[model samples]
Target chain A: MSRLALPRWSLIAALSLLTLAAAVGSLLYGAVDLSVARLIAAASGEGDRVASVILFDLRLPRTILALAVGAMLGLAGAALQGYLRNPLAEPSVLGTSNAAALGGVAAIYFGLAELHPIMLPLLATGGALLSLALLFILSGKAESPLTLILAGIAVGTLAIAGTSLALNLSPNPFAAMEIMTWLLGSLENRSFDHVRIALPCIAIGTAMLLWNGRALDALTLGEDAAQALGTDLRRTRLRLLIGTAIGVGGAVAVSGAIGFVGLIVPHLIRPLTDRSPSAILLPSAIGGAALLTLADLGVRIIPTTNELKLGVVTAFLGVPIFLLHLMRERRIW
Target chain B: MVNIVLDHVGVTLGRRAVVHDVSAAFAPGTLTGIVGPNGAGKSTLARAMLALVPANGAVRIDGTDVTAMPRADLARRIAYVPQGQTLHWPLTVERLVGLGRLPHLAPMSRISDTDSAAIERAMERADVLELRDRIATELSGGERARVLFARALAVEAPALIADEPLASLDPGHQIDVMDMLRAEAAGGGLVVAVLHDLTLAARYCDRLLLIDDGRIVADGTPAEVLTADRLRIVYGIDAAVETGGEWPTITLFGRAP
Candidate 1:
């Protein structure tokens, strides 16, 4: 009813436009270079069959994957940040993204990648859940936020070790390629099959993550304070665990591994939403889609001898920027 | 009726005994100052009372043994403000204060008008109403201190326990905070806090529990527990007790060279 107070409506509109532009850009620009007019015409059944084939067969799936992957990474990242109450934290730092990478890599190494495509997401999700559980147990002696992060780092290292062990034993040369793919992250050649597998898990996870907003807000004070306020600490933590596992697990499952989108998207958008966890979440979903699609577009245009992985570009872009921000904003840490 | 009792309570954290054999009775509707030096197990004692620690004995809140009470019930009974809390992120003071309503709020239910009123009233009492829209992180030390108290106030518990509530505040805010705490006790809520400023505690607290080496060395009215000789033994600081006006104040004069 009132537009003067917070940036709620403007942010929503900005996010909507950004999401739309990115979605359209995802469908049109690439090596095949179908113009915006052509892609739209094809989708609306006015363009030729060849244009329709390019739009539907290749661009459409990739665009959808971009949106799904972005939303997953962004929401997952936002969850980690909100859960830990640390701006610097994300799925990668907490081990979810890396562990998911290891799970997907193991899936490829065993040559069982296709046999149960579901297995890959499950394994990745398992890795995330297991690490989160270990973090809780091991960090019991430690105090509030620090304990969780320290435990996450330790458990993530363990998951990475397991991933390494899997790769060491695989006889498939494709396993090596898969490792590179997982390391770099990709949305290239993704099909309806890939989208189908990832979207549901990501959707379920995002919903769960969004549901955690109220609890996360409660947690900003302190655990005991949050509990005193009637926040069911154990139950809230459980939901966060499941949601993080599903969303990060699913995104990692399809992309292999991506870096920084989770951290960057949330940090950039959090202030814009007046720091309301729920409001920030949806914007993060939309912003993440835009960022990833733009990155994916950049990877396509570079024309390098060797194909660039989305993970590499994301890390290359994400790390230094995060560090600079961290240096400035780490006044409390 | 809101009195709390600790009977032979002991807490060991990470293989070290932080609090040992703490047995005492806290008077209802009175501000009881828990005074001790650094690492004197003040926080440990508060945690034990909340049943946050696996202690050796019983902590009874309003006559119900904390061990037998549901954690939710216990949450409803006591509101605890821990020490040196660093809440990162730009949380609105109102939102942060509203978190105190968590115990009273049902799961998945919307905040009722009563909850809204409670939060507003709590904010006013804690003097954080103008800070409602401000970020918690951006508030001054004095403002932040009160907002935290507002959060505790929002809990609407019969007993409120704070660990060194005024330790970080400037002298003026320290006095203001101490007055607010005394008001809570006067309002029939049991209030307990660990204090470092002997003068402030002596002037404000109705009773004092002097602790040393994880045990209560002295427990009585401020004048009784805060004698010069006991202050030397408990805090290892030389002091002379003075009587100016009706309040007996502690003046620490270092032994002659």
Candidate 2:
């Protein structure tokens, strides 16, 4: 036990450093490069006006959003995996993000989002909640990982189908194209307003997930044993479902449906923490922030005629890592 | 130390009664074995005591209705080792055992010195101290069983209920587990085990409750409960029961004619 603590702490520390570096990289490396001196001058209110506007107003919010959204996805993934007792369980895998996306698309399609900006996230959160309720109803008490995943796939397919139908039926092609880009997920051009919209929901949701850490640990013994250990399984399930909805909902609203960070982060960090579900929460959050921020950074730096989509980059990075982990730890399932 | 009382406890699953009108009292400082045929509701009855399953009648722990008691408080009084050997995560043995301290912890609080001591002691008692750092899912069947046993022991609850604790263990580990249950009872905790092995049950249990079709058919000392007539009637087998040794031994010959 004494031996285990040191390495986990160091891993967390390393992840924190990586996130910090990523944040700094997000701030400094952009379309218009700003030196450390220029950034300092901007902070002190004496730099180029364009540089100040770009640094403070543009890059900072985008960077913070990346961190917050990444952390939410990561934490939600860990919590869902722990609650479901399935290593492959994540927001994307469970169709919550797609559901949220459908909700956001519906809000835009119906012009409710034009009435109020918060309507998108609220509707997205509602969509996520609906999907979870559907999942519970479809899967029932069996709680088998396969049934849950199949149900999730069904829900995801339905939501995606709905989204596509809405796009196809839209009279305005430009609007459809715009929504498609947003759905593809990018960290570009987001201001503090998007951050304000997402931060509270993400923060609250993340707190809810983290609060159930001990319960998740107890759950490693399975539902019956966990209840015997005094874990309120029903309450834990409620919190997990609601928490993932709010976090992933807000994330999907602002940045579109980023995939695989949640799936990849926990599995990567589980070994470092001796596979204790509770111990993996914080590291998973930080690791997620690092991964998404780095991915976002990669999208910015890669010299493409059209900038790479954030979601595409993450899926590219994450799917291979997930498959590798699957191959390496085939016995885990 | 607390006593558990089940009064007319009945469990129905989807309009079908799985266990019906069963009543029993389990006192501290005694190890009781519940022996029964397959699907005779032994596990269900055990689960009902801890309110893991909803039951028709009352189950009380020291005069308090278990359903009325808060989950954590009941957990403080009872620790359960479930039947299956399946664990979802491949957590280290020490970490898995440490999960027993959950009921005793405040939400978001770290493990205290007392929790650590209890965990260490449980691992030592279960003889899994040497395997503390090993990944639990990677352990052999018997080894994983022992690790799970240590997890239950770490709870330090007044009553311990184990469902089929000897199910997959070899003879030596089975004996070791039975002895551990006996030791828990001797140490002033109520220990109830759902066991299929009549010989082991007769050997270690201070009392035996034999159930058939979810009803307690015989409840007495091993010598009384393991009678040839009862064995033939309940199990449809012919058995020679020996009471000369310190532990009652049963030798099965053939089908009852």
Candidate 3:
């Protein structure tokens, strides 16, 4: 135990430092290129008004949202994987993110989001909760990866079809285009309001997921063994479901269903934590933050005319690696 | 010292009575082996005692009903090693064993010196001390079983129930585990193991429980319970019981007529 603790703590510290570097990089290395001097001056309220506005209003909120949403996805992924006892379990794999996106799109289509800003996140969270509830009901008590992923595909397809049907029937092409861009999941032109909307939900969700660390560890021994060890299985399941829904829904409301960050980040850092499901949470959160921030930064740096969508960047970076992992895991099993 | 008393305990799974009206008293300083054919509810009986499954009747630990007891308190009193193969992650042996101390830990608290000592002692007792740094998933079947046994021992609970602890073990490992359970019982813990190997049960267990169709047909010393008549009646096998050595041994002949 002593032999492993130092390395684990160091790994977390390293990942945290990397996330901080990525966040600072996200602030400094955008199209405007704010130097460290300019950033310091702006932070201290003495920089050019334009530079200050760009730094404070644009980059800071984007950086913060990236961190929070990424951390939420990573944490939710770790928790769900632990609870379900399946490494393949993630928000996107289980259709919660797409379902939440559908909910956000519905909010816009029905004009509820235009009337009140909170309705977007609220509806998105409801969608996530509903999808997760359906997934749980379909998966039942035996949480085989096959059952979970199949249920996820079913829910995801239905939610995507619903979004498309709404798009097809819309009278306004501009609203349809806006929904399409949102569904692609970009961080462009987001303000502090998006950050404010997501922070509380992410905070609550992260806390709920972290609280189940011990229970998750116990669950690695199987449900009956874990229950015998005094873990409250039902409560753990409830907390995981609601917590992942809240976090992923809030993220989807703002960023519109970023793919594969939840699935990829935990697997990336799992070996560092000695493969202990509970131990992977914090590292995965920090790693996810770094990965998403870097991915978002890549979207900015790339020479694409319209700027690559954040979700596209993540999917492009994550899918091949995920497939490789799947291949390796298949051989081992 | 703890006394686990089962009073007419019954378990219904999917509207089927898997275990019905079972009664037994397991006291400290004794190792009880639950022996029966497959699907005879031995595993379910162990689960019911730990409250992992809901039972129709009462399971009392030191005069308090287990259903009414707090889960952590129940965990502190009784440690269970389940029959299912459930190791999914590739955690090191030490970390896996440390999880046994969860019931004793406060939320967010680190494993203290006492917990570490208990974990170390458990690994030593289970004879897996050398494998502490090894990953659990990479170990052989018998080795993993020993690591799991070490995890249950690390709980240090007064009452220990293991379902099929002998499964997948080689001969030497089988003896090692049986001896460890016997030692635990001798040190004043109530150790219950569900076993299919009647010979090993007759040799090591202080008490033998014979269950057929979720009912305890016999419960007594090894010699009393491993009778040829009982073996033929319950197991549907003809067997010769030999009581010449330090322990009674059963030799199977053929199917019961």
> What's the C-alpha lDDT at position A330 in model 3?
94
Q: Write the per-residue lDDT of candidate 2 for residues B169-190, one digit (tens) a residue.
A: 8999898889899999999999
* lDDT for each residue of candidate 3 in A184-215, tens digit (9 for 90 to 100): 88777778888998898889889888899999
Best of the candidates, DockQ: 2
Complex DockQ per candidate: 0.44, 0.85, 0.81
Worst lDDT 10-window in candidate 3 chain A:
A1-10
- Between prediction 1 and prediction 3, the one with superior DockQ is 3
Worst 10 contiguous positions by lDDT, candidate 3 chain B: B82-91
Clashing pairs in 1: A184-A311, A229-B102, A229-B103, A230-B102, A230-B103
Q: After superposition, how far is residue A116 of candidate 3 from its true place, in Å?
A: 5.2
Q: Which portions of model 3 show Cα errors greater than 4 Å?
A: A1-6, A111-119, A132-154, A172-176, A330-333
lDDT of 1 at A246: 73
Worst 10 residues of 1 chain B by lDDT: B248-257
By summed lDDT, which 10 consecutive residues of candidate 2 chain A come out lowest? A1-10
